[model samples]
Target chain A: MKARVTVTLKPGVLDPQGAAIAQALGGLGFTGVQGVRQGKLIEIDLAEGDAATARAEVEAMCEKLLANTVIETYAVEIA
Target chain B: MKARVTVTLKPGVLDPQGAAIAQALGGLGFTGVQGVRQGKLIEIDLAEGDAATARAEVEAMCEKLLANTVIETYAVEIA
Candidate 1:
């Protein structure tokens, strides 16, 4: 099985990295770039298993290491 | 309408940011943490509209600014 985890900053959080990227892009001549926010995507290959079990393990991974709960939120998908 | 765009590093991409985070977590006394990959989630609240159009717009957004297409891929869901 393969799973993907995405983690992002919550709304209202200031994303300095994102802002900087937007500026860089604009300077690179990519215009009309209004706002930019940067986040992360994680893809994991797991032992073949059921969706329920995969969900459980992925949740543990997120809580344990994949995410910084203080500033981000995460969602998981298994395929 | 609300749409979520999830972007992740393709496998084999070296994630220095994630590695640094793992190290910091270990220093903070978190044990048994093996690997970490970071990604991003983008949530957009759009004008009430059609799902198909929302998808198109979000796709353009990802291409234009939200992601560094050089190393990342993105998926969008409209809800």
Candidate 2:
């Protein structure tokens, strides 16, 4: 089984890296870019299991260490 | 309009960061974790435009600066 966890900054959280990226894009002539937010994607390969179980396991992983709950949010996908 | 670019290490590339994450998970007692790969998610907010246009623009951004084409691959999503 494979599970993917997408971890993103929570709304209203300041993202300095994202700001830097947006500024870089503007400097490079990509003028239409308004804002940018950066996040993480973690792909985990697991032992054989159903989607439901895999999702639960990954979500637990997210809560424990994959995400910084105070300023970040996470979503899990299984395949 | 919003677009997302997912940048990941290419197959066969060594990912020390990912290895470190897996090891950290093991230390934290997430026993079922077999393999782990890490990537980046970049979200861009743009002026009103069609999804196709937004996707194309983001793809260009990925190719130019978001991804290291030699060792990374990227996918774009628009909403």
- Per-prediction TM-score to the true structure, in the order listed: 0.59, 0.96
> Candidate 2 lDDT, tens digit per residue, A1-79?
9998999999999999999999999998899999999999999998848888888888888999899999999999898
What DockQ number belongs to candidate 1?
0.26
Q: How far is B60's C-alpha from truth in model 2 (Å)?
A: 1.2
lDDT (C-alpha) at residue A24 in model 1: 67
Task: Summarize candidate 1's per-residue lDDT along A1-79 as a digit string, tens digits.
Answer: 6777777787788988878866765676645445666676776665646888877777777787777888988889988
Docking class of predicted structure 2 = high
Off by over 4 Å in 2: none
- After the best TM-score superposition of candidate 1, give how far the Cα of residue B73 lies from its true spot, in angstroms: 6.6
Pairs in clash, predicted candidate 1: A39-B39, A39-B40, A40-B38, A40-B39, A40-B40, A41-B8, A41-B38, A41-B39
| Candidate 2, residue B65: how far the Cα is off, in Å | 0.8
Candidate 1 local accuracy as lDDT?
0.73
